[model samples]
Target: MSGHLDAVLARVDAGLEQSLERLYALLRIKSISTDSAYKAECQRAADWIVGELKGIGFAAEAHATPGHPVVWAKGAAQEGPHVLFYAHYDVQPVDPLNLWRSDPFEPTLATDAHGRKIIVARGASDDKGQMMTFIEACRAWQAVTGSLPVTVSLMLEGEEESGGKNLPPFMEAHKTELGAADIALVCDTDMWNRQTPSITTMLRGMVGEEIEITCADKDLHSGMFGNAARNPNQLLAEIIASLRAPDGRVTLPGFYDDVAEVSPEIKAQWQGLGFDEAAYMAQAGLSIPAGEADRSVLEMLWARPTCEINGMIGGYTGDGFKTVIPAKASAKISFRLVSGMVPEKIRDAFRKHVEAMIPADCSVRFTSHGGAPAITVPSDGTYLQQALRGLSDEWGTPAVITGSGGSIPVAGDFKRILGLDTLLIGFAQIDDAIHSPNEKYDLDSYHRGIRSWVRILAALAV
Candidate 1:
């Protein structure tokens, strides 16, 4: 098994340029799913993926959705655990185009000051480059052994950057077909660093709300209604300010009812990861910790729930001063939830808190945006051990189990709909600048990522 795996990895190493050429071919397509003008481009990307999969002998299709088409594929049946690999082909919109060094749609390579070769493009280091790692790995295995080590399926979503509006229903509609997988693989996250590999074991959930407050029939001049008029802006500010306590704890009623403390074992593992608080703060231009005062930075980020005011609008001050008491004020608030926290319950509690704070003369309306519960995959399992062993063998370093502060809704969807646990393994670094201008993926990451997946597949075959 080791000799065969070595031969496959050697093939991956020797064919690295060909693998990159294929990835570049897909990245050159302007598959910006959010823009209507690029709908045809998205279709072209899907069609390209279908063609590639078919060439590799997989049963593949480009299925249409209301928003964008999803590319689905499956390899021949094999005597091992069935795995569903999920990734997105769609890249983010490239606004502020002038800020980019090169055309985002045109894939290019340049050496960084540190002498590392980086691939610069819109979807580089994002799902497109990441997804190719898995595909190229499968291709190498097929080229070497004539078949995949395990039964494999691919679900390449086209709407991930645009809120994935069509994915849930698509998954529900195809539940029976997708649920046959024993586990899943996701490659849309970052590694620990250039030298270290990490697997995301926990992901925080999310809930968003937009609230509008109306106090009067129309905007009022502060001169005429200086003391008499009820200012919605002032009231909204108060409501927002009252949401948190001096200790940085959310004051909403029952907000902490389901919140759980970080386990000691997990905390120990996180502490061993050498997380640099100063460096993290410097990245965001902050000097002090902003969350719960007593919690460590990692705990605050990965384990604790948080309430943030994403945006607020009320008064009028475009260019000059306008002393107008706006009749309406609105704010967008988002909550990062953790394990054991319920989404609907937290949303209801927040709404109740706001309603209770509103004055009788003022009316408040709430708009729900999105909500999802936190996801935590067990740290120890057959698939997890296999992945760990494989990754350690490939990187020559132990794979760290880490937690992600952000949410990946598809991971939770797989658990809820397909009853499959997902192993998140990727080669991108934290400085990939995904969804930002000048996004890049290290050439070494792309090369080694394919080899890592090959090792993982061989380990799983055992």
Candidate 2:
């Protein structure tokens, strides 16, 4: 290890207890963004983060949004590349609180079956703990070297758990303030495995639409006008059925017109990882590949575009049964898009398809929820190399570049609004129970995460 990194690691080791205490203090705040009752706590959490950043010698402040506040901070300016760090201070609601062995807000240190020490709390692994890894690293640097090696801007949001409606506008308003960075470091993703470090390279985009079809002016009794009146539910089902073929491919014309095929190099790398398709299916209580017949599970999840019906409602779905031909039927649909596919184009094509299917007796109305396109960062960037090398130096294994199945909308916003690429790195594990009952962060992950950032900073400085 380099001498500078060794010094930073030493400082982190010396301050490990203090770091845990700070994390415990933040975890105690019930900053649940989805619940209006926790609004004050969210502000308190933002204030606490601001204080922590200020305490570490950064110029920090808590900026209010329409909902919760976002903590913005910056370290001393440097000549090298600047990195904008992003994470969330808010956590998911701790419902079914009876399931926890301890208070969700009162964090405790416990040992797991494998003898790994863990931090048990509400936001232990989701984000609070993960974000602290970077903060603690900065603290270590400030302690040992008296300043950060490279410049950093920290942006912690309190509305991530509530769909980040305020983040885009906030970014738009502060484009000049937030746009002075080459890349972003987002600590909201997970590693591929317990011992393996990963850098996420691709994220799927999302598009949502609500379609309502009206066939009759009013509901008619089945016994009275069942044969004469057309049922909108039947029409809705027919239209939905026509969207996909028996071969599992979407039937919409020009839907896959812009989708790019997965590169052979990526295919080979994914194959070498030896992903277990059966194991993944077993976890979800299934036995079949429900997507494209020829693609592997990894390809289907990481690279393919898909259409799914999120919800549908037509007739009465209440207590009993109503024998009536419903006047209107509605369905909510979403598409997961890959590279080269535009959300607006997909929305236009879908509207066209539905319009062509509508009969003379039926009328249709479409409501479009906004969407963002998919993004794939170059895997061979210098910052990525530095991060991978740093992680390898700390963990004795080269980091793997993987693709995330879910969308991080803020990432797209960063690229679109600010023209910044993001480096998604975090220490959360799959079984950490994020957004579920009994959330916990492994103590080992916390310790090594600080150490990892120490090395990453050193690498980036070089």
User: Which prediction has the highest TM-score against the true structure?
Assistant: 1
Q: Model 1's lDDT to the true fold?
A: 0.92
Off by over 4 Å in 2: none
Provide backbone clash counts, one per model. Answer: 0, 0
Over 129-180, each residue of candidate 2 has an lDDT whose tens digit, in order, gives 9999999999999888888888989989999999889999999999998999
Q: Give the top-scoring candidate (lDDT).
A: 1
Write out the backbone clash pairs for model 2.
none
**Candidate 1 at residue 19, lDDT?**
91
All models: lDDT? 0.92, 0.91
TM-score of each: 0.98, 0.97
> After superposition, which runs of candidate 1 have C-alpha atoms over 4 Å from their true positions?
1-3
lDDT of 1 at 381: 88
